[model samples]
Target: MGRAGDVAVGVVFGGSRVDDGQIAARQFLLELWHRDQQRLARVLLFHRLPITLEEMALQISMARRSRLAFLSALIACWFGASAFTYQLALPGRKLVFPTDHYSHPDFKTEWWYYTGHLTSASGKPYGYQVTFFRFGLRDKQDVKSQPLFTDLYMAHFALSDIAAKKFTFRERIQRGIGDKAGAATDRYLVWNENWRVSGAGNDHRIVVSDRGTALDLNLKSRKAPALHGDNGHSQKGEGEGRASYYYSLTRLQTDGELTVAGKTEKVSGLSWMDHEFGSNQLRDDQVGWDWFSLQLDNNSEVMLYMMRRKDGSIDLHSSGTLIDKNGATKHLTKQDYRIEVRERWKSPKSGAHYPIKWRVAIPSESVELEITPAFAEQELITNRSTRVTYWEGAVQVAGTARGAPIKGKGYVEMTGYAGKLNI
Candidate 1:
């Protein structure tokens, strides 16, 4: 349904100005642009244009600098101004698996996020995060002259060596040139460079390798998917389009191999996966968010996110979801819970102060948690791709539920602390 039709037409009529390669290439850029993937759309467009062999070298040099300069300005124009043209995440959205697990081109932004805390056979603890993002540039039908696909694909992989108190992360961005990166729409598969995540049924595999760290894990969901908010229509703000279709597989049994410093070890643990998509989510007044995905020892999971305003108050739209052991979900509004910062840590690299310790409580549910980080420094400086600095780290949760002592591991994400999170 993409460039295949254009390719067939060009081949049947023989090569011309609108040959198969030209049509396909243009469509590729158009698709990216249409989806609001402006940087990649412009990068590939600059690279794919015809150039004489003599001038190719010069053009390449110029293109490199131009692309860099253009991308540097991306923070000002990241998601295109086509929010009205794209489909918004309104209420009453239905989510079908296999299809929804892949990519959503109609929406402006989508992400497949996985994070877990693992323990090696030797008793060493580890934490990891692998996420794939699809950013749409423009609508496909907008390309009138040539078939163009203007979408950008980005992925981030991180591993935390809790014992060593070290965290490593890598970020990548691709224009899908020559099939180097892409996401399958019919199935659960997303990849960039050598990193990939593929799934069938409730079983998923994550493979990521970079520098001296690698993670190869197989995750099988132990419970049904938990729909967040009103039937997965998660509201981020009071505006019409400030929402998203959000769901999570909060408890997945994980097992596989992880390589650190050239040493591979067998590991097993529980993972949490969050998939959300929509055209617009954060409102203009919202600056950032603090998100927690906790998997308690009691087989229960809690997903909470607080959207923070410039005045340091939690937005009214902040909410959460409680996934019971039976896989049933209960929505929690802003007033249902409280998050008190017990301690804060400042990052030396970014000079941003982030709360590393939190006192979290849901009085109605009788769940109280003291969230502490495995390490104080797990910040990700993603200047290469997303161009945002944020903290995503393994956390230890200790507290009580219904008067019963409980403890577990989870992940906490704090954004806008390093800088204003644009997307």
Candidate 2:
């Protein structure tokens, strides 16, 4: 992709060389041209040449150029790679009330991801996950098409239905770098023709569907936004830049219809949302993670996460929060939580082991909860866009808090264990 984008960037550069001294074009368009050429020059230029130790210094000095004037050339080198597809960058320190919210672009990747718990009118439980991801290709030169309306968006929508002691999962992928297919501007909604998740004010709507399974739903949020880490400075690892602007709508009131096996039924349940975007989302040594969002009987919500590293150690930055039924939030650190796997179930389809039973303990308040899947076959298979498989389902909750029978409903995300997440 870099070679292709470089060829395109090169042509723009060639054209700019012809009009070299035109001040009006040089200041704006020519600069955009130079910035883009410098980006492509980093990769394509070095590939065809040999650099001496002194040339290395010159290459390092490229950062003195405007393209990377904001950050160091060494660090900016990674951002210039082919990994960048599309980008929206903003500079700031903290999130303002209601303003620092919503999707952020400057970060490497951002997604409006939704996975939920549902029950059909016939009393059958179901699960669904629909995600829209945004990636930053920092340099304007990363544009693959001068056609402006070219495709720049990617989406994945999936559905899982559990009934009659069986489960079914379906997924769809969307590629619409077009303005109409996946247009995003002014904080309004955007989608690839159909699979959509967007909002204006307090009302939001999302829809993802196909023949075997579908989601035609309306979600009205009750709880306000909950920021993760220090005002959206959620860290991914010990590294300085390995963090993201992350937050979640712990609980959203869901009333919608789901279709399974050519049958559509009206359903209502609780949905959870996570919105995060950053550059280089994962750490080099981080293996995968187990994330859970449980709504307790006490109207409190507990979100726990454990980042598995290659050395089998847990990353301390892998922590979540406690949101009361009233929507107030309390942050949780390394000392307050523990997740113990009691039994493992291997997916017959993917041949991966997933801990079916978990003993979740939060030592801060001396609480222990046992999470059992509503059924053993809650595993999901995506035929559309995910290009991956995992288990996402409703679970029966049983636990004791202060020796009282406490019941809760929640969702758990088991990744990396199945296979390293593509992201």
Which candidate has the top score in lDDT? Answer: 1
How many residue-pair clashes does candidate 1 contain? Answer: 25
lDDT of 1 at 120: 99
What tens digits encode model 1's per-residue C-alpha lDDT throughout 116-200? 9999999999999999987765543321211122456788998899999988899987654335566666567788878889899
Clashes of each: 25, 18
Alpha-carbon local distance difference test for all models: 0.78, 0.62
- Poorly placed runs, candidate 1 (over 4 Å): 1-84, 139-149
**TM-scores, one per candidate:** 0.82, 0.73
- Over 80-154, each residue of candidate 2 has an lDDT whose tens digit, in order, gives 434334332223456553444354443546677787778888898777777776533333343221211122345
> Which numbered prediction scores highest in TM-score against the true structure?
1
Angstrom error at residue 279, model 2 = 1.0
Per-residue error for 351 in candidate 1, Å, reads 0.3
